[model samples]
Target: MTLFWAGAYALTRVAVDKGNPDMGLPVAWVLPGRLTIGAAVLWVLMLARGQKLPPLRDRKRWVAIIGMGLAGSVFPFFLITTAQETVNSSLAA
Candidate 1:
């Protein structure tokens, strides 16, 4: 997890760097791409292990899942990507 996060930070920095427009990618593209790919990979792994998703009808479970996703994944990704525009990746990490 540490290594994964470190790499992500570095990649985010690269993606947001204005000095390297050729290499830099838009935040709009990078964030969604990262999230989608990560989610898909995890979903595949879970399916391979026969893990079941929580029932969508469970309100509490749905709330918890949404909260965790926003807090743990989405918020941080947005914050980091935005910050990387002004801060160095090494410092952001």
Candidate 2:
């Protein structure tokens, strides 16, 4: 976990560095791509584990799930990667 986080911080730092225009990925592209791939992998794993989402009709539970996902998962990563654009990896992480 430590290594992965370190790498993520380091890599996003490089990726979002606009000073190196030729080598850097666009900031707009990185977050969504990372999130989409992560979501895909998680979906596969959940299926493999025989897990299922709460029914769509369970509106409160569904809302809670979405809210927690946005707050806990997506928001933090978004903030970290965006911050990485302006600061050193260690500082951003």
Each prediction's total of clashing residue pairs, residues at least 3 apart in sequence or on different chains, is 0, 0
Which stretch of 10 consecutive residues in model 2 shows the poorest summed lDDT? 18-27
Worst 10 residues of 1 by lDDT: 14-23
**Residues 9-83, candidate 2, lDDT per residue (tens digit)?**
787887788456567777678888887887999999999999998889999998998899899878898888777
Q: Please write out the lDDT profile of model 1 over residues 1-93, one tens digit for every residue.
A: 899979988888877774675677878888888999999999999999999899889999999999999999899888888778778888888
> In model 1, which regions exceed 4 Å deviation?
20-23
